[model samples]
Target: MLNIVLYEPEIPANTGNIGRTCVATNTRLHLIEPLGFRLDEKSLKRAGMDYWKDLNVQTYIDYNDFLERNPGAKIYMATTKAQKVYTEVEYEPDCYIMFGKESAGIPEEILVHHKDTCVRIPMMGEIRSLNLGNSVAVVLYEALRQNEFAGMNLEGHLHELNWE
Candidate 1:
């Protein structure tokens, strides 16, 4: 399944929403700290609601730890500076779709290090970027669509609806 990684995410609500997305899609959510808000913050818990317990979420202390643990996993940095469109890439089953904080995109060093894997969502006019939560959902669903929405076996999991 596709993995969602948020690097230094700022908003609790965005993280909460992404947690819900991960739960609904059966994807893994990996967060690289330090985060702006606590996971147990009222806003986050509220936005995530009951789905927080349903989400398969993981936390990493830093990027180096994530890299060391998941070697060879394709790390695609979503940025406005990239030349390739995200949809053009062949989405891998264990790929890491990484996003940065809401106010700024990923660091230049990481972008340059993973230049070939960098991708961007096309935009028009003066729009710089999409909301953090929305961007994760868009990229995640696209990858899931490419993979035919695997592991989404909702048939026997009727009890999930009662989660949130």
Candidate 2:
């Protein structure tokens, strides 16, 4: 299973949408402390729809706490400072794909320490970054695609059709 780590997310809707994505992809969600909005916010619930309850979410006191818990885990930090494109890295199963907050992004210390594992989404425009939820979807889907979408339903459609 892949892990999607949100470092001090500032927006409820983004986290909520990311939660839905995690649930859909069968990945785990790890949230760092100092969240900007409450988890029970209406905007979040609305964005996540009914899948919020099914999301596998874990909260950490801080980045160090997260590192302590998942010792030796392969982590890929998504940042604009990284030189490597996100798709260039070969994602391994159980690898953690971490994203920073809406405003500041991942801490400099962590990025510096794990510089080799840092990756970024290439953008042609003048924008510095993409939406948090969209970025998660983009990277997570790429990882899943590389892994052959192991646990996902690849068949025609999710629901069976009865055309009589």
Candidate 3:
């Protein structure tokens, strides 16, 4: 399964939607702290997030905390400054794909160390970037697609309904 890492995400709804995506893909969601919102039951209810409980989520105190816990993780950083396209890389099934904050993106301090692993989603010249949630889906789905959508159902069935 792929792991999606959000470094200091600032939006609650984005996280909630990412949590839902994690659930749907059977992926893990890792959140580094200085988070913008709480994860308490009341907060989840306020966000109308029902499947959060089903999400395989983890929280880290900071970047070092996350590195200490998941040592040797095959991490790929997503950023606009990257030369490599997301699809060009061969993602391991257990690789960790990280996205930076909505405003600044992963600090150059961190990305500097992982230059070879940095990737970008191609976009028009006028656009600054895609939505955080959409960006995650784009990169993540590429990883998942590379993995042949493993352990996921490829087909959908219609519910039973008849009209005269």
Best by lDDT: 2
Q: In model 2, which residue pairs have backbone atoms overlapping below 3 Å?
A: none
Residues 45-109, candidate 3: write the lDDT tens digits: 34437788789999999999999999999999999989899999999999999999898899999
| lDDT per residue (tens digit) for residues 1-164 in model 1 | 78999998999999999998888887889989899999889998888889999988888898898888788888999999998998989888888999998999799988999889898999898898999998998889889989988867635533545555
RMSD of 1: 5.1
lDDT of each: 0.89, 0.95, 0.91
Clashing residue pairs in candidate 3, if any? none
Q: What TM-score number comes out for model 1?
A: 0.90
User: What TM-score, computed on C-alpha atoms, does each candidate reach?
Assistant: 0.90, 0.94, 0.93
Q: How much is the lDDT of residue 18 in candidate 2?
A: 96
Per-residue lDDT value at 47 in model 2: 90
**Model 3 TM-score (2 dp):** 0.93
For model 2, the local distance difference test gives 0.95
Model 1 clashes, total count: 0
Measured with C-alpha atoms, the lDDT of residue 145 in candidate 2 is 97
